[model samples]
Target: MTQQGGTWPDDSETVPLDSGSAPASFVPKSTARRAQSTRPMPQRVGAGAQSYPDTSQFPAQPVSASAQGGAYSNGAQYRQYQQNRQYPQYQQYPQNPQYQQNQQYSNGWQYQQYPQYQQVPAAAPAVAAAPKRTHTRKSPKHGFLALLMWLATAGIVCIMAIREIPFGIDGSRWVPLIAGFVPWLAIASALFLLLSLLWHRRLLAVVSLVCLIFQVVWHIGFFVPTTSLSDEAKQAVTQTDANGLPISTDKYARIMTFNTTTGKADVNAIINEVREQHVEVLCLQEMTEGFVQRLEAAGIDNVLPYHIVAELHHGDNGGCNGIWSLSPMQNVSGDLVEVDASRVAAATITLGDSQVRFVSVHPSSPTRGNQGIWGEGLSSLSSLKEYDHTYVLMGDFNATWDHANFRNILGSRFVDSSQQSGGGFHMTYPANSKIPPLIEIDHIVHDKGVVVGDMQTVELAGSDHRALLATLEAQ
Candidate 1:
């Protein structure tokens, strides 16, 4: 077939799709420009297609014969098309302007172009590699430590479990109070871990919640206020002396008990706390001779005139117990019993028409062999009972209210001031510590004759033992 563009047709060359049409320039100048402007101009391909008038400027096609399996012989248009098909991103502009499909050419010939190739769009960006999850490889010995920690946790739980049985000695005594929060913490951790593992398990969630609620309810059932406020209010209303008249609380006494660590904490801070609270009777444990000297030197005797300090003779650090009073004290002496006795100091004070005996007892702590000593100290206090006079026993007993000896022995005769006043869970001793205290060992025990009112814990600076204050009124 003959070519309509400026040349006779070559059998090997690609013919126009509509070979009968004239070239792009054969149109009116404005129409030709409009056709050219129909789309954005492309970037330069190798060079302009050969103008037939300038056929000498044509570029040689990169041709290969058996160069590789993908190569072609004779530079066949179909073979070149096959190779060019691999890069589909590059578009091949068709011969004869696309807009000329409806237009009829008058007469002039149009030039044919060589093949052109350009990137119509850039190569699609490779998908970004997903971020890798970071993981820390624990040391082999960490497993051993974790196992030991778990064993310790289990052991504590066991001790608290049989606390009432006394199977583990001191660990079993008053330990259930410490167990209240442990199971709750463990349950919370387990629920979170289980959620990560079995998020869709409704039974597990329900069981975990039930267990948590049961533990909380169980603790509340045991440690909740045993003393009835209604009964206390009735007692307060009905309370009378031998004369059958209402006893006046206007004439009251504020007593405070604090363990001072044998002058380890700032004595000035303790003194300031006592003075700020306007304490009438102040008792201190771990009160040594040096502490007494320091106190007297610090003008404590001026504020608290009546002072009776016992001398410690137990362990090396076993300091004495002292009672400082605002009013005149009588029969003030140390409870120097046979075993674990030097830690007690007793005195008597008169408020209104009533005379109340105040005893400051600091029994041995429950550490190793000290349990027996603690028991002995407790037993000794149990013997010093007199129904004739009202008694106020206040100090660090070194035994929580949950102790068998405390409930069975001490509870047999006297009432805990905290229970009577509805003072819930006032854990004293081991103060100035970052870790929360577990149990209440410090107490203000009083005979039924003495009316116990609001009791509070005073946080003393620089001391490991918190100060306990209990309000007293005559009954």
Candidate 2:
């Protein structure tokens, strides 16, 4: 029979033995394995429990697993060891709960990843291309502006062409009258147009540009050379001298004046014209020594052998005024009336039986406050008693008839050969430009002479001004 404190069958009751036989003891087969792991002793009871006993064979208790608390060596360690063993078995039901949570978390992470990749698709390439197109647009603005400027320039050129055709008539009275205003009008209009364009005023630019073009075109034909009388016409127009010789009956005294703009006078046309006309007299301003020498070498020396030179700088090859006459001169003395170059010389020339006097004079221009060259020159000469003789006073007065000095000469007994012989306004000065001629500043003044015929503006062969010619009959 089983004694007290003996183990019961792990399955249920103990196995049946013979009826009288002592009940067989129940023992676990895995006890030895459990004892090895836990170091069991003979005196322990309960499930999986072990006890260590004292042994006398050794000096001290052997380091048994039970005394060491089943490999941990302390009670707390034994408890932790027990907890570690219980965890794996206890975790089985908890695994099912975690499965559902893992499924939810995995789906959420996948959803977030889908959006991040979608954001990288079409949007990134579109953003990168935008600035490149904007840069390309900016590059063509300069080209567009250049095209606009070309259009504006072409419009101006067309306008000028239209205005030139009507003004080209040879004897048009309006030729010289309108020629003078074109330059200032062009300059003013151009300035206005540029300012308007700068302000982005399109209409103003167009209007100003049109006006400027019109002014330029209007004067284009006014410069056709003046209609000169044919050689046959000139011969028919004059009466013969007492000797039955052809009289010196030219209607104008042609003279050319130049500033020369330094020493270089590049007037091939004037030089050629002078050769062609065999011009009887020539007058020049701004005669440098080099120019005089060049002119002399070129055979113009005969027309102006007696030259009165004024070096504007005392020595600087500047402001030289000189005269070239066909007739011989005598008693030539140049007295300083206002300044050294302001002087007059008298000469006697026999025109048939009548002796006529020729006086050549030049006075300072109204520059740097010298306000009265015309007045001073005329007044000084008219006051001279010797001038009572039949005289022709000729030179560049540097003042028009509008000035008191020129008017005094006109208002006094002296007659302008152009008015008495020819008709209308004879505008001179500013020789090379196409501007309207204003004020007759150069003149041939005579006293008590009958005007024989017409006045003429000679061809512009040289200098900035055309020469004048007139015929006078001494009674």
Candidate 3:
């Protein structure tokens, strides 16, 4: 075979030997580029293939040696062609400039000038910073102590109420009346504690209601006017005349006792009732000079003129005791009984065919600072037993039947005209309030010789207590 001018196989070098061997046929790299370009692209392989005319720039492919080993040998173009026959239509674009320009396409990796979007620096992963710690505070045990102290103060007030007990020796006993505050405070405290203990249940509500009722009952007895008397010592000795003549019949007298509250509208109402009822004897407590003057001006005669105690010093006389009688009054004296100055008097009156003795007393009320005085006054008055001639003892003793002192008086020989005649105890307090009336603190008590004819609560004036009226019959 004749040799070509200059070009040789890229991987081959000529050697002067083996003249008897057969010469192989040459295949140009251009032909290979054309063949590769004309072939269809592979379906699975995403990699693309391009062709060049000159082998000087294109990468060379290694020759295969054996079919079993996926290699090639000399004079095996047919076999090699069959091996690469999957891409038959691939063609080289070295001869076509227009095709080369068409091949310049944007792959996924190539970028176009799309408004020059600046590649923002990728934000570093945010560090999970540790949560900031804060210090906390709390109240100490002393705070609890402060709260307890507040509760204790209220508790003490309640206890004071329970300690007050009504204990007296006679019907005219006033000891309990004076000592009422002690038990009152103590009971209140005990009740308060009980309520607190039961607070979590429906029982609490029930207990609270019970306590309220009990307290109401207790206060009704406390504030209502009552005369503590013992009948044993107050026996009506005899009925006699002013001349010591014994003339007796079933005749009686009307007596009334009232608390006028400084002679306001209440006193006027009391006086009006007394005038209407023709009460033979009228006893009033918490008397004022203006009120007495007004009553005197209103034709109230035979008033016991005496200044006893001064609860208040308003207008030269505040809460003083006085008695207004239709009969000639005697033994009119106003002195400090136990606490403040008070009035006491006796009068002999002719009732129809009988002569009756009337004793009026104004005792100190057991209120706040006057508790001691009330107790002493009640006891002192009960022990007097000075009158025995068909006498009627009536006044505002400032104690209630529920009190021990009042019970003691009941035990005495004195008869409660109201309880015996008026059916039930009549309460007279907080005149304007709608709550139930309290007790018969304003009272009429006499020895068994004097029978209770009638008893009632008269019309009220501007006073806190309604007027008490009683008619007694000599036995």
Note the clash tally of each candidate. Answer: 1, 20, 66
Q: Extract clashing residue pairs from model 1.
A: 431-464
Model 1 alpha-carbon drift over 4 Å, by segment: 1-161, 166-250, 314-317, 336-341, 385-388
Q: How high is the CA lDDT of each candidate model?
A: 0.58, 0.47, 0.50
TM-scores, one per candidate: 0.53, 0.42, 0.45
Candidate 2 residue lDDT tens string, 175-229: 3233323344566568767866765657767877877767655433223222233
lDDT of 3 at 255: 62
- What does candidate 1 score on TM? 0.53
What C-alpha RMSD separates each model from the true structure? 15.5, 22.7, 18.6
Q: Once superposed on the true structure, which residue ranges of model 3 sit more than 4 Å away at CA?
A: 1-250, 266-268, 302-318, 330-341, 352-354, 386-389, 409-411
For residue 345, give model 1's deviation from the true position in Å: 0.7
Measured on C-alpha atoms, candidate 1 has an lDDT of 0.58
lDDT of 3 at 47: 69
Q: How many clashing pairs in candidate 3?
A: 66
The residue-by-residue lDDT of candidate 3 on 313-369, one tens digit each, is: 432112766556555544444442333336555555655566666666666666566
Better-scoring candidate (lDDT), 1 or 3: 1
Q: Residue 214 in model 1: shift from native, Å? A: 9.6
lDDT score, candidate 3: 0.50
Candidate 2 to native Cα RMSD, angstroms: 22.7
Comparing 1 and 2 by TM-score, which wins? Answer: 1
